[model samples]
Target chain A: MHVDINSYFATLLQQENPALRGRPVGILKDVGRTCVIAASKEAKKLGVGTGTSAYEAKRLAPEIVFLPAEFARYLDATKRLKKIFSNLVPDYEIFSLDEAFLNLTDCTRLYPDAQEFGRHVQQLIKDDLGEFVTSNVGISWNRFLAKMAGEIAPKGSVAEITAENIDHYFATTEFKDVCGIGRRLEKRLAHLGVTRLYDLHFVTDEQLETEFGPYWSKELRKMSEGKEPSLFAHHAKNEQPKSVSRSITGFSLAKDEAEIRAVMRNLIDEVMYKAREMQLSGRWAAVSLSGEGQHWWSHQRVDMPIRHAQELFDILYHQLYSQWDRTFNVIRWRVVLSDLGSWETTPEPWLPDWQRQEKLEQAAQELNKRFGLFTVRSGVLLQRPLIRPEVTGYLGDRQYVLGP
Target chain B: MYQTIHESIEVAGVFTPGKFSPTKFRWGKKTFAVEAITLLSRERDGLVPIHHYSVVASGTVFRLSFHPDNLAWFLEEVWQEGA
Candidate 1:
């Protein structure tokens, strides 16, 4: 069963504010951010939705109420919902902040009917989270079909996809309804005359590969047959990642060098903090920057695995930024530390400078942990707004998803 | 428009076994009687959980927070009548 909260962040806000109930609401990551991160049911009906610009949303529905997101509340709600899942199911996987999958093999006897199980979970959510908080449950034999079923289900309702009903659904559903098929993939599929989910069933695997490459072709074929190419337990708590990355899209295009550097430092600080918390370091580092139709990428294999933020920043300055033409505006930037290994495997550096740097960072980490993140930061960051550690609405951060 | 103001304030509430019902609060020099509690949510700051009460008072919506660590109440935000 795939349980997906409908209009999650927006619904949470509506649940909190009684006045917001039945009203069109657009949630922003922060005030002044033009992007609408999520839209209420009422707003969605008026064509406002996730990724809708604030300008476009207002034009769609002038009466739309825009509110800044409160991630803390969302996280709290997730915790409460997970507790309920733990009690009801023998096993469950948290798919995202607004979705989870429950393996009902053990509990089948308890809930013989799919709708009954869905209603029971919905009631529990309302009782624990709030009355306005509702979920759609998709019941199927496998994960992919279950997620598709959940997406097709009406708000606050349950839908099951079985051998008898899947064909009907495939014929009626658009190609985009499939999880991995985005606009680009949909366009490519259309070029091959595969316009619907039903059309995918007729296409040969060899044809799919020619258009989508090997990985996607295999996945698409599996999706077409209502099979998950990956294991059902893909949503299970992931092991310590091979790479730790932090990326951000600026609210506006950034042309200034200082602003770009400040943002880069902030992201590096976040990446290092998580690595330190997990007691891991990386030998490979990569930086990607893109904006205004220009993209640049640079990566290096360090002599030693590095975990300190300052050292990582120095490497980036000397190797990456110093080489950049600085011709294009930067709207998005990403920093990745790959080739990760546990601290137990890392050999101790013999240099006195390295030792002193480690000691200084450790002291700063202690202070920050006690007070809050960025309580102690570099002078360069002092002039910029402190980019505090914030959980994504998608809840993709493994460290936070796995929890303490 | 809602304004963020993390100023410590005095709150009057009834403490029951599992719930805390905030009725009124004193912000600056004025006392606003909470006509209704629109919503209540929880947030964690470090090890402490702060209870936030969205109360409608003074013809506006005011978000009041109770910090258990300090046993203090604060006026977190206020949505005014007009932007």
Candidate 2:
């Protein structure tokens, strides 16, 4: 089963304000910014959708209301929605803030009727969330088919896809209707005269493998048959991160070597702080520099675990500076710490001053946690003010206050 | 349109035992009995926790916010008919 909230961000704003209900609304990260992140159904009817600039949206609907994106509220609503699902279904995967997939094969015995169960869940979401918030529930044998059904389902309704009706569903559905088939993939498939979901059945596996790799070819074949691989059945938690990176843009571009080094140092500190917070140490650090049409990167693997920002910076600073071209006018840089392992698994420090340095670092972290971030900072960081973190979503950068 | 009004106001409401939802509130010298709670959400301003309430009263809708740190109440916004 797949459940998706319709125009989730916009709907939440409307649910909170009665004046916004039934009105064209657009949610923005900043009202002063032109980009529209999400648009209400009314705005969509006026040809204003996500990624539409505020100017374009206003040109389409002159009376459209613009509201700043409130991710905290959206996260709270998602938690409530997850609680509602937990009471009915045991296993589910949250695909995004507005969509979730449930494995109802084991729980269907409780309700007996899958369609009725989907409808009940939809009603519960609407009643518990708000009258303005509605969800489309899809019932199918697999996650891909279920998600497709949800996309094609009418607003505030349910659509069920079974072996009996899947053929009919595919006959009218386009390739874009299926998940994972974005514009790039659609254009690639269109070049091979495959535009509809039914055309996937006619394409040979060898032809698919030629365009996509063997792994994706097999995955597409399974999706064509409304079946997902067994690996996707369970929802895994607490998976280790493959890499930790921190990069910043939208600031004054670096014009000199000092500015470039400062940016790199700041990014390294953020990534290292995150690593220490997670109690993980990395063996490899990579730095990427990008400017007006040029990009350069350098990577080095250390024999010892790199746990401190200064140590990681010392390694990358030499590699990055040696390759730096004075003409590029660097605008952005990224620091990535990879090949991570738990701190317990890494070797301990053996230097004469290592213990004193470790205690000093711990004290700084404690002071930052109690007072605020960067309350105590290295002298190098005093050259530039720390960049304000921007909100993305539940998984995005978060702003925390120190005291109650 | 949502407007920002940060003035502090007086609120008279019932605080039941073990229940945090306010049954009614008086603002602008007009008393409104909360017919239904449309939404209840919590957010923060710096270090202060703010509780927001969307409620329906006498066919009109009101948005209220309470700051527990200093026991402050604010009538954030009101949506009257045809406005």
Candidate 3:
């Protein structure tokens, strides 16, 4: 069964802050637009959850504690927890930072039942890690149903979502609550009057085929029937970020528009220069600005194709200042390059030619090699830097995120 | 502990310029700066941070170990590198 730890990050914050005990809390990431990634169990009891925006969470629970994410710390903690899991369950798959699954179907004799096995895991995590990690273990025939069971169960509780309760789980849940289901699919599924899992389960194969196409119709039916593809499995070192991003906080709310633009520019130049030096590019660039009283603004690259680092930076640099101007003091700024596209120097049809593109790439390389990545930068990026000699890049020639 | 890591960093350039790595941590989160950002459009292999005359004297290390928390974080990474 899947063991789901609700609001693991929020729980960590609450546990660390004695003052935040029993209070609603939200986790903040550099992606300021992503209101809330996780909320504390207390917040959930108040009907706040994963999709709850930070603004909404703040409105609901005015006393909510906002915690910035420190991914490195969480990674360290997860490793410690995983070590305990390896010792206890010979076969366990870490699903995410806060969840995992133990194949207890074979080890039924190890505990009285799945619930006891789950209890043992919960206690083990809390005791070993010295953190209160309440896990909801779902016992089912397979990994998919088991994970669903864990998710639907009450906090610090366990329930088996078998043929019996599977109906209840789907009936009471939204499309997104179903793992592997996304919004577009849900809306598409709705077109066939299959708005609920029961609707999908009861739909004839032909009707499903008519709606989702031949291949996916049966797949949707299988999912509705409480079956899933597979459990989270360990892979080689391939699970990593396609690109890296860096952002910072701390600017006056009174900074002028030009001053704000300069800061954004410095940040852009640093990231672009480093990305260029590293020979990496992404399909989407995430730019975010956070200000006083929990105000956060984010703009994804809408104009550029986001195929390369320079392109991503160019989009972010132009858009942020043009939009925010000097209206708000930049409490923080972040840049994330994601959706790593193909890494090749194919000739652009618009500006096609090996020589021209190579010439541009070569110029950037030479400037970086001579003066370090920061030595010579685009004038667009050198506008700001009220803060002298700012921090830049994971190291000399790279941005971070794909995990060094 | 401070002196140990300080030693692994190699100084380069004519005028006590920047530093280069004399040792590299070879595992898990201890990333090679080269492999850190797989999508940043870097044209080179890795980075050599320019410490700058101002930052060095500005006490980068002093600021790092300024508090017990920072010291603990630094020492742990340093220790983890070897272990």
Best by DockQ: 1
**Which candidate number would show the highest TM-score if scored against the true structure?**
1
Order the candidate numbers by TM-score, best to worst: 1, 2, 3
Q: Residue by residue across A1-404, what tens digits does model 3's lDDT show?
A: 67766677776544443345588777765334446766788887776777688888878888776665545445445656667777876677666666666777567677657777777777876664445556687888877778777777778887887676677778777776677677898989887777778777667888878878966776787788776743232221234345556666652453566655666666665555555545555556767777766555566744323433355555776665466544556668777766554346422335555346546766776776664555555564554443322321112111232233
Worst 10 residues of 2 chain A by lDDT: A395-404
Residue A32 shift from truth in candidate 3, angstroms: 10
Individual DockQ of the candidates?
0.49, 0.31, 0.03
Query: Model 1's lDDT to the true fold?
Result: 0.84
Q: Is model 2 an incorrect, acceptable, medium or high docking prediction? A: acceptable
lDDT of 2 by residue, A1-404 (tens): 99999999999878877668999999987646678989998999999988999999999999998888877678767767877877888887666678878788897679789889888888888887888889998888888889889998888889999889999888788876788677887898788888876788999999999988887788777877777744354333344655788776534457777777777877777777667767788999999877888878889998988888777888888665566556677877888999988888887888867667677778876676555456666666785867433334333222111100
What is the C-alpha lDDT profile of model 1 across B1-83, one tens digit per residue? 57889999999989899999888889999999988776677776454678888888876788888888779888988885346
Displacement of the residue A170 alpha carbon in candidate 3, Å: 4.7
- Per-residue accuracy of model 1 over A123-173 as CA lDDT, tens digit each: 998887778888899989988888888998889999999999999988888
User: By lDDT, is 1 or 2 better?
Assistant: 1
Which regions in candidate 2 have their CA more than 4 angstroms from the true location? A229-235, A246-277, A284-303, A306-335, A350-404, B7-10, B14-19, B23-37, B44-50, B54-83
iRMSD value for model 3: 13.9
